[model samples]
Target: MTPLLVGVLGVFGLFALMIFRTPVAFAMMIVGYFGLWILEGSRAASAVVLTESYSAVSNYSLIVVPMFILLGNISSAAGFSRGLYDAAFAWVGRFRGGLASASVLGCAVFSAVSGSSVATAVTIGKVALPEMKRLGYGDSLSTGAIAAGGTLGFLIPPSTGFVLYAILTEESVGRLFMAGILPGLLLMTLFISTIVLISYIDPKAGPRGDYVPLSQRFKVLGRAAPLLAIIALSIGGIYAGVFTPVEASAIGAGLVVLLAFGTRAINFAGFRGAVLETLKTSAMLYMVVIGANILNPFLAVTHIPETLGNALVGWGLGAYGTLLVIILAYVVLGMFLDGLSMLVVTIPIVFPVIQQLGFDPIWFGVVAVIVIEMGMITPPVGLNVFVVKGVAQDVPMATVFKGVLPFLLAMIVGLLLIIIFPPIATFIPDTMFG
Candidate 1:
């Protein structure tokens, strides 16, 4: 029938396929290609698909994706997570709920290299969960803290999510990376504060257990020097304009390799494993990118996003009300869908509405990320929770979900803070890239 109706049906059908366990990339590509062919003759639609795929994939800016992915893969294999946790533990393990706080800091540090939330959750869980449980931390707090902290992987600098968002929205990659720094640190602080508050309320949740002596703590600090150096150099260098995003990723990757090699942590097996995993992950991501390109034009043809935006803007709701509605929608959608899929499916509609309301895209990116982070911890389909659960099969799923509640509250606060004060997301990018 009508083009708009066809677009509507296409989106629903694609989601239905995804619900039935079809791979997201394949589902979108298949629907998009056929829809375009139906809308335009087969030859013309096929040509459009080929051209979009090439242009999207061949852009030099996209090299950052693989380089950053390789950086994360290499660092993970090299045992950076252990060093990161140990360092944070050395400094904080003596404080109240110290182990839990260390988990947050460790996730933040590890995220600098790993950049993938699931990887952060899984890696840090392996390193932090055992110690937290051994130290008599409650099951809910221990599991929940790690699960919530892992999401910082996507918010912090060198984030894979940010990279993908930038590519899709045509925002500056470097600026988007810079935009993440403050919000990431602020959210990490919120998580830490949540742990302290919880522990304070019920000391039983996290027993002080024992305090390491200052002299011994210094020794623990020495063990973490490698991680500190890598984080400062990579993130700091990028901010200082010392390197492009791709170059910074490359440098980060190289440094991690050398450090891992020097420490004897990364051997032949680890090196090979890192490379292979990187290739596979990179390939999978590119495939998704290719699929999005195929599907996006078809969605545009439908004009549903435009129609929806106009309706929202036409409503008497002020900008703040509109934003609140969007965040609520994200939280609800997050319960059932993964963050990347949500982004691809919704940004076409959301971005235009947001821009029409006089908000900056970079600021909106930060806001969108925070909303998605909430989804990562929420029920029914929280990716980070499942990741932690997979590693912590002994812990009940409900306990893990319950523990992350405070952090989820904290994420909501973080989102509000950014919304009320846009500079929280824009200050760094404005100062550095303006």
Candidate 2:
């Protein structure tokens, strides 16, 4: 059989494995190893598997993954997320829909430290959800805000999504981090605005929260100061050229650990748990990275990306038109696949097409992340929506999904703005590095 046909069958088999409850990493590895064996030989397949696994695990740059994960886990154990929520609430909770808006802001702030959408949603939801419920905020608006806000974890600096994208595409991790800042803040603003609009249409849906006094606001800010400092030091160090992305991760993780210990927020038992959780999460990520690396070569040998890129080019859609088609495909695929799965599966195929169209890789990285973030809240498989549901178990699934729609629309608008003016994603990296 032709290599292209083999590649097609391999993809089908991969999906089949996924449907049968196979882990994505192992499924990709299984398909890739055997596909390579069929095309080449057992010797080459074994060699590829060994080399790729070792290389993927040993790559120094990958250290950023665990460090950042550890930072987030440590922060959660320390209860820093509560401080972030309190600080945001102190400032914004008095206005109409203020509690929901503060949830968004809190998610955005916590995302800077946590770098995982589920963590952001779950952490902020625990704090903000109860408060919103007490204030008579509708379940839809409260759950929607938290779910939508959690997506910032994928777009903000220290993002695991960006790290994976950089690993897959061989782009600069620091540049990708820089590129996400403006777009992250932009999306946060849009989410907050959506909450405002919702409350404006029906004030009862989001009753005004009690105003916080200046003394209390400052006190809350003081409580959150440590986390804010960590964000500035880690992300800011990258911008100032004081640390590489890996170094920044190390610094951030170390500082969080120290803070947790110094404040006695976590004892030895909690610290041990954080380390164990970090190892588990890091190992999972490493598996996916190794699997994608293995699968990439098989796809390359089969010339699938080349064939797909040429086919798209032949469709006679101009650059922008083809780009739109690609974006639409992501929107559809997102309904079923999680963001990382969609990203790892498609980038190998679509990135070549993106390069052929002359779009900047850094800018595309930012745009692609935003698209993936949208998937985290999209229906049928919105990961963040499910995460928020787990936190707000009393809220119906449909209500949570309903809550995310306006925020999703707001994200679409932000995506459009990024497309129309690429600098929205590119300006920071250019200004800083160039």
Candidate 1 per-residue lDDT, tens place, 156-192, comes to: 9888788878877889888999999999999999999
Candidate 2 — number of clashing residue pairs?
0
The digit string of per-residue lDDT tens for model 2 on 20-41 reads: 8888899889999999999999
Supply the TM-score for candidate 1. 0.97
TM-score of every model versus the real structure:
0.97, 0.99
lDDT (CA) per prediction: 0.86, 0.92
Cα error of candidate 1 at position 347, Å? 1.1
Cα lDDT over the full model 1: 0.86
Which candidate's lDDT is highest?
2
* Model 1 / residue 123 / CA error / Å: 0.8
